[model samples]
Target: MKQIIKIIGNPKIFVYTLIWLMVLVVLGTLAQRDIGLYASQQKYFSANITWLGNIIPAPGGRITMVVILVNLTFMVLFKHNLWKIKKIGVLIMHIGGLLLLIGGGLTAIFSSEGNMVIEEGAQSNYVDDYHNMELAVINTSNEALDEYTVFDQPILGKGNILSHENLNFNIEIMSYLKNCEPLKRTAPAGIQYRGMLKNFMLSELKPEKENSRNRPGITYRITNSGSSIDGIYGIFFGQSVSQTAVINNQNYEFIIRKKRTYLPFAIELLDFKKVLHAGTGIAKSYSSEVNLIENGIPRRVLIEMNEPLRHKGYTFFQASFIEGLEGETTVLAAVKNYGRLFPYISSIIMSIGLLLHLLSSLPKLLRKIPGVSPS
Candidate 1:
């Protein structure tokens, strides 16, 4: 531990880490041309180690960041001699940098961002994740309210058996295609295949540039379920219908859709207003007039591009609008981040540190000037 600390504490390691981070940025940008932005970022910037063709391994952005963090921490605490009179400004600057890093860590871990779409006069309480898929088993037996049990992407991997305490039966996954295409079946399938699966077959397709555009499909066999309700089940993204199962005298529908985050409050779109650039179809600005309903109470608020509605740590911004035959659909980009104030706070701290450091050195600078005397 002592040897490790000494190596990280060395001033040269900080310089090396910065150089490595710059290299990562350049390489990651270039890699985006081939593997796309999301893929490149995941491999290079997100992961702790980047593998080259399943053989060679390289240090990733996270690893470099950790190194820099450790080196900076040592520099601030030990090397600079904490609580020194003359080094106060430098220590404050280091503290600001440390705070920024901590904020980044918080954002990376606790942040949630997604989109909420509400048509004119419609209300929605959930936001759909941009890239992750979720298997929703909704019990529609109750007339009053439906019960939803969701399985996130981690459990929906290929060949995984899904069994929940709330669910009566077990689901044995046969295939889970990341991107799939559904086509009309030429021949009739067995009795086990039901619903949309009977008439259509899902095949693998090349993934789309936008991860959300990729329609994922799942094929699974129902087990521990009786003969009537047991069979091969299939579901896919954007499927209008779902595979129905009767368990314990309750009707449950299984559908694979984008993961949803249900918020405490709901947003009802009252009006969608847009202004076009002069003589052009492009929108200069767009805004959504929505009723923010919380705890059975409604409050009118306008969400715009520049001015976003922030409530209870969630921020809703007017991202885009879709024109439809019935009504206009407003897409609100919702973000909930614990570290939202970190950047601004860190910037202020850093600025104060820089100003203080400059002022502290002003006397020496004045001494160097032959004509200027230190008062």
Candidate 2:
């Protein structure tokens, strides 16, 4: 046991381990699942934890495990004499590689992403739209209370109960779909009316037009008193509560669907400016001027595709453009994570490792020169 520890603890062995670690990380990244091809690095980790039976399934576990195993195996089996100055540079290279691995791991565990869409003249304090599905409750009576909020992840969909005491409700999400247009079902007409019906209520039949039916929300029933309310509606966007229940003389609203990923502040699209490369008409740069309202204060900001504006824990980027009466207007975003900094840090470390490894071999080449003294 001590011999194994001594081998790994050795500086020479450590450097070789880092070399293999770099190779493994590269291989792992390339060997990820097909879904990972277009997804960000953060998506890899979430996918890993989503599968059943294994901690990480086929490709994710295979790649990560191989990396760790190869790194350890190299440290144990290899013997490198790094006591000389030539070896010091090599050691620096390994240290940089270690930082890269650590940075990538941190990024995988802690990063999240979603989009924010804002229209002209519209002021919103919360995220206006999202691709993810969630369940939230709002008690208009108690404005101060958060009521109940539930997010449906892979694990949560597998039958985990979410409860809130303030509003006295328990929820279980049966299924959810986002960024999709689904085949809507029709409500039965045979049953007698049990509650108040409003004229502005949505049609019982699914709308025929798909273009106008862009956002698709979740449909989950509720356990009301004795008989279950099996057919409840949760419209697209946020707060899709179509039913009102009276509990202790107060009306409580139950929402089970998707909510728009929102920011603390409001972003209004003012105008968009586009510059194209001359002659060829290739795009050079595009930017948006936006009006941000936060805490009753409005500030004008500029956001470009790559050059996003970050304010109050949100990042605003120019996602899309609309040709309106004001020439053109762009979609200014409010992103949760400003820039993906962890991967950049990892890139820097990897670069340092490469530079040091190159420097370490220089002395050996110099010593090989004819008539050169050992000193």
Candidate 3:
């Protein structure tokens, strides 16, 4: 036990760990060129273990940083004489570093990132996750309101069956494709798909390197009382497929779309303006004018590229714009981070610590010079 502690508390081990972290950063940056940003981050930074070309083992960014944090903690508490007056600056610096590590860990675990798309003159209270998807079974019997049962992406796969107590029918996943294209239905069809899919066939395509660009398609069968009612219904995002199945005498609509997170307030888009540079297609600036409605109260606000709106622990930044047939749509990137202020706070603390250390060491540094003398 003491041997392990001694090794961990060694200053050389901490330096070695930092060197390894630098190597990981360089490798991860180069990996983005081949696998893209999202895939590179997942493989090299967020994961616990990573492989080089599916064979060589490497310690991931998360594990390396965690080990560095532990090493810093051990050095600060057990190895360094932190109580000495001369070590005050060192102590403060270590404390700041510890806070930064804690903040990073919190951000990694508790942060939420999503996007909201609001068309001109339309109001939206929900944000969609960029990469994650869900299967939505909506009860649209009542024209006034629609109740939705959403199943997240975890349990979606071939041969998987999902059921709920309130639902009298079972959903059997027949096929799932990460990327697919709709083609005109031709001859040599094995089983006919219902509704919009009847006229078109879903052809599986290779997934894009950028995962956000990939559109998913799912084919599911609805069975009730040991009988198939909806025969191989297919759904995909960005498709205008309107099909309903009657289960327990209730009409239900099914679709596969991006996962949504409903916010406490709604945002109504009033205007979206984009300015382009002279004689160039590059956009100079883009802004969105919107009204935030909450609890029957509405407040008009403008969001721009660098300027973001922070409300109720969430920050909204104007990301991009999309043109549609009806009108232009504004895309806002929403981020909810619990440790948003940690980096700023830790930076201040570290700066103060560094200043103090420099001040304390000035006399020693001056004594080493022949022409310079300390007062």
Candidate 4:
């Protein structure tokens, strides 16, 4: 245990770790050109271990940061004489750094980020994840409301069978594609697929590194009592209507789409305005006027670039706008980070500590100067 502690506290080890982190940063930046920002981040920073070009193994951002945190903690607790008055500022600075590490860990585990896209005059109470997808089965027997059950993407694939208590039939996955396009039906006669999919075929496309640009497609069969009921149903993102299946005389709808997170309150898009640069098509700025409706009351709010709206622990920033058939659609970048303010708070603490340390050493520094005498 003593040897382990000494090794962890060694200055050489700490320096090497920092150098490795810098190398990772350089590699990650270069990788973004080929894999894009989101993929590079997942591969280099978010992962626990990463292989350089699928060969050499290296510690990832999370692992490197964790080791640094341990080294800092060991130095502060056992190596430094923190109780001494002269060392108080050094102790505080270490504490601030520790807080930053804690905040990063919290963000990695708990933060949620998604997007809310609302057309003009439309309201939404949910945000859709950019990369993750869900398989949703909705009960549409009632004309008033629909009950939905969603399954995360991890459990879906070819040959996987999923059954739910509320569902009268079991869903068996036939085929899954990360990126695909709908094609005109060209299969031979006596084919079994039904509904709109019968007229359109699913054509596989090259998957994009940016997951949001990829259209995922799934072909599934519904089986009841060991008998195939719905031949084969194809569903994909952006499908106007979900494929419907009738089992045991009950109406059910199935769809695969970006996962959604429901918000406590709904936001209604009142208006969206975009200003263009003079004599050019480039956008100068864009903003959204929204009505935040909560508990039967509505509050008007404006969200603009660099200015975000915060309510109920969620922050919504005006990210972009799209032109749709209905009009302009506003896309709000929604982020729910519990440790969002930790970095700012830690930075303030670190700055104060650094100033105090400088002040404490000023007298000693001045006395060492030639012709300078202590007061």
Clashing pairs in 3: none
Which is the leading candidate under TM-score? 1
- Per-residue CA lDDT of model 2 for 152-264, tens digit only, reads 44434524555666545455544444433323335543232222221122223442232224344444434443434423333433333355666555566655454455556
| TM-score of each model, paired residue for residue | 0.93, 0.63, 0.90, 0.91
Worst 10 residues of 1 by lDDT: 77-86
Error of 3 at 69 (Å): 1.9
Cand. 2 TM to true fold: 0.63
Clashes of each: 0, 2, 0, 0
User: Where does model 2 exceed 4 Å of error?
Assistant: 3-84, 125-131, 141-160, 172-217, 224-268, 273-285, 292-298, 312-314, 323-329, 333-339, 342-360, 371-375
Per-residue lDDT of 258 in model 2: 40
Q: Model 1 over residues 29-75: C-alpha lDDT tens digits?
A: 99888767877888888889987766989898888888888888887
Candidate 4, TM-score vs. the true structure?
A: 0.91
User: Rank order by TM-score, top first?
Assistant: 1, 4, 3, 2
lDDT of 4: 0.87
Per-residue lDDT tens digits for candidate 4, residues 101-126, read 88998998799999999999999999
Error of 3 at 157 (Å): 3.4
